[model samples]
Target: MPKIYTEKHLLLFLYNELAAEEVVEMNAELAKNPVLFEQYQHLKSGIAALDSLSEEPSQTSIDLVMEYAQKLAAAEVANV
Candidate 1:
């Protein structure tokens, strides 16, 4: 029986989480199914767009995280 690939499988393949065997199988399927190939292309482009728009946390956000970590460490020391 042939495997029926879903969007989740495609996402796993896109994110490099697919096993080597699965990668080969999915690639073959993509080649044979134009609709699957189109979906993959759309998802790939969406991921690229998201990557381009990604930004680092602001200084204030970094400082807040650091302060929280320090407070947590101090509380742990007190308990010890």
Candidate 2:
């Protein structure tokens, strides 16, 4: 398989979106290509940082979302 040359392709590998055969091909390329190794490191760091992000929604946003959801539910019931 050809070396992955796009962020989308790299993301597929980084996120385990690749099929098993494709992943094996990618690992082979990664072993031979220093540039691909560096790119992988960069992407791995980015994904790790993203994974560590906090999940708690802000109170204001949560309230607004809940309000909108209630309005949608009310509208749906009224249309029934």
Candidate 3:
């Protein structure tokens, strides 16, 4: 019997979480199955968009974290 590939499997395949054999199987299915290929393409686009997001925090966030760390270190030094 042929395997029924779901969106879940496509996501796993996209993330390369599938086993080597499974990857091979999914590649074949994606080529052969239009609906599955479309779903995979949508997922790929979403992942690409997410990947394009700003990876670093804002400067204000960095400053706040640094301020807190400095205060904690000062308190520790005072305690010692």
Candidate 4:
């Protein structure tokens, strides 16, 4: 029986979450299926856009987290 591909499967394939054999199958299907290929291209572009974003949290967000952690540690120390 032929394998049925879905958008979810294409996303999995993009992330390399598919098994080796499934990767091979998906590659073959993408070649023959224009709709699936288009979907994959769209997903790939989205991924690329995400990858181009800043990898680290903003300084303000990091400061808030550090401040909260310090407060927690201080409380723990006071209790001990």
Model 3 — TM-score against the truth?
0.72
Give the clashing pairs for model 1: none
Across residues 1-80, which tens digit of lDDT does each residue of candidate 2 receive?
Answer: 45546667778999889999988988888899889889988999999999999899899999999999999999999999
User: What TM-scores do the predictions have?
Assistant: 0.75, 0.81, 0.72, 0.82
- Supply candidate 4's per-residue lDDT for 65: 99
The candidate maximizing TM-score is: 4
- The better candidate by TM-score, 2 or 3, is 2
Overall local distance difference test of candidate 2: 0.87
**Could you give me the TM-score of model 4 versus the true structure?**
0.82
lDDT of 4 by residue, 14-72 (tens): 99998998889999999999998999999999999999998888999999999999999
Candidate 2 residues lying further than 4 Å off, grouped into runs, are none
lDDT (10s digit) by residue, model 1, range 1-80: 14877888888999999888889999999999999999999999999999899689999999999999999999999999
Ranking by TM-score: 4, 2, 1, 3
Q: lDDT (CA) for every model shown?
A: 0.91, 0.87, 0.90, 0.90
Clashes of each: 0, 0, 0, 0
Displacement of residue 5 (Cα, Å) in model 3 is: 3.0
